[model samples]
Target: MTRLISALLLFALACASAAVARPNILIIVADDLGWADVGYHGSTIATPNIDRLCREGVELNRHYVSPVCTPTRIGLLTGRYWSRFGNTGPNNERCLPWETETLATALRSRGYDTCITGKWHLGSLPEWGPRQFGFTHSHGSLAGGVNPLNHFYKHGKYMKTWHRNDRLIEEEGHATDLIAREAIRYIRMERDGPFFVYVPFTAVHTPFLEEKRYLEAVKHIPDDRRFFAACLVHLDEKIGEIIKAVDDSGQRDNTLILFFSDNGGQNPSSDDSRRYPDTKPTSKFKGMNTPLRGWKVQTYEGGMRVPAFVNWPGTLKPGRSDALLSVTDWMPTLCALTGFKPTANLKWDGRNIWPMIRDPSKANRDRTLYCKGPGGRTRMVINDGWKLIEIKNGERFELYHLDDDPNEERDLFHSEPDEVDKMKRILARERKADDDARPDPKRKNPSPV
Candidate 1:
């Protein structure tokens, strides 16, 4: 009877050990999605699945990113500001350096099957692709974004669509649909082990190519905003599909899903009037950054602020966090969640947001959030409730008290000179830290623009 009890105890321990294993991670990133584009954020777009994630998880209201895609991608992958690596250049290929450590590489070291699907705007260099960056399986465009219809690469060059494991495969559906399908397939195939699936959808970006079915569904919304809303809905459906796949695989309880946008939306003026005033308003291309000033490509809150949500069925309780977090926080946060120790020598500008996810009320991340605009021409820093903006070659400084003036209309540079100086000193110290860590002096530029 003692031997029988010993055997039963051993079986119970084994089961418990299996249950305590690290959970699977799914990071779904939407390209150019606005702060209010998702349903939970007060948009009319039918994003039920994404909304569900927000409802059942933690919605990060004060999440921010780079003004554009490439820099934000670099920060999200490396857990450091892209400027530290000289990746703040305007071009997409210049953002993701070849030697930098990525989340995939870090997770792969801990026995997680890392896979990336959809846009890889980091670099198109053969050696810098996702497969080379530690993702075992990668399938998507190598450029910043793509043309959904022609499957074109950067500069309108046609490249063969990719497939599982970097294989050149042809896809018949929209780019978003193809990405979603592959994500579902990967989840089903790797349900047994801990996996990291990075689904960075190239939806609602540029080259507005909407599926006819989605367009037809939103015909009643008028032509101008119809395609935009439909694209959002399509993305929402794809999100639903992936969520269902995770549930169907019986890993729902052991999976952690994060949803967020890479950056703000692109606002193309009608008839390119902003570029050529003679032309009429042809197409009204604008992102819904309603209450915030400016849009994409600017150093304003509307350009950097993005919607972020984290959902882990059994781990994180449903709630909303106003804790100021940035894309740079993801790497360290994920490492903490998965019990992986980050490299001792690797200095990071972002702190782990794991505590915020676990208990939103307990988070105390009040550090300064810095952002560099295109070509590093414009720079801004948000510390406490004040935002200090410095435009390239501009003599005057623009400061906004976010608590009182969230829209950034009231410039308090002169009114609050003391606060501005305090933030400037902090910003200077942070920039020096970044400059000191650089391996190459030529790559380090204090003035971004």
Candidate 2:
């Protein structure tokens, strides 16, 4: 950790001496993408573009996010655990408060053109959409996952979440293609300075729809697996196109491209499928996060631990960081990299991890990573190598030494009573209980669909 701090200081000194050009930022988030789904993670799904990044970029091997969409998005934008806001589930209601500063708004203040071209589940309505909160140009689904071709939000009041800017609109194309093209168009648009593009693709989430080409490509796979594989291929190809666009714009050298999942993949049989109204009736959908226990909405590794990498050709050194990185770290980290001083009251729980990313050994694993499952029903805290998980009303507790039991197979509740007590106390201190969200109906039943 001392080495990491020293590296951070040295980097700061270098930046102070040199006039480094502000780099363009591209953050791509895939919904419900499994930890092992990408080619870099040994999945057979063709993700050559993503795999390329892993080979030449700083792969974040221990990145953690919330178990679901809204919380993860909240943390990424606010640099604070979403639990502090009190809502955990999908947050279908008003999510971010008006006073909150988003990643786009922060970068926009630094003369960067900001745009978002994908899912915006922060608040599931046009009135509470991306334009109202930082993104200068916004398009695609404003709600959670939507019907890929139909562009509907799972048949609800905000079913028509598809839009351009803050107004509803209909565009004829695959959602993935449309999002990638919008991002490409945004990159090509004449702008005065650097840009921040946030593309949160709604693919691999639900309502599993794929075009004929992708379907035919993955035809060898059976049933839902084939459909899921096609979705991955579509997403991967679109990502390749977006990266090409950045390269064509001559921003490749300075652009910082980040790719990660919003949360772990969903296992329909183990998950509350009821929430996914548009999902088709397949025997058992293919979303693999093997060697990890539990699915989304649970305080398990499979739910929060996800795939992430940062590729900046001239800046970050290519390597892997097993450090405890979180979705909340981006805001502060970017602020540090771009020299954006935040307001006094914007208290952030995440620290600048520039040095840590450059070298994995600088990982300060002692920092507590607090996680609150959907509905505040489940809570988790990991400090150092020990972890503690507790069910709110169920009055259940599970403890594990993550260093020795990364799979969380052996519960140390009784074997390591002292460790359990210590972690429980730590969790008590970290749990920020708040109740400002819509009720999560899916928590009671795993297969809602």
lDDT tens per residue, model 2, 86-188: 7677966767666567788888888889899998888776777788788889999888887777787765688788899879998898889899999999999
- Candidate 2 minimal-lDDT segment of 10 residues: 440-449
Tell me the deviation in Å of residue 241 in model 1. Answer: 0.2
lDDT of each: 0.75, 0.83
lDDT of 2 at 305: 91
RMSD of each: 5.6, 6.9
Error of 1 at 433 (Å): 3.8
Cα distance off (Å), candidate 1, residue 117: 0.3
Q: What is the C-alpha lDDT profile of model 1 across 271-303, one tens digit per residue?
A: 222222122232265457767777777888888
Report the poorest 10 consecutive residues by lDDT, candidate 1.
270-279
Identify the runs in model 2 with alpha carbons over 4 angstroms from their true place: 1-21, 270-279, 432-449
Give stretches of model 1 more than 4 Å off: 1-21, 89-97, 156-169, 270-283, 363-365, 434-449
What residue pairs clash in candidate 2, if any at all? 271-446, 272-446, 272-448, 273-447, 273-448, 273-449, 274-448, 274-449
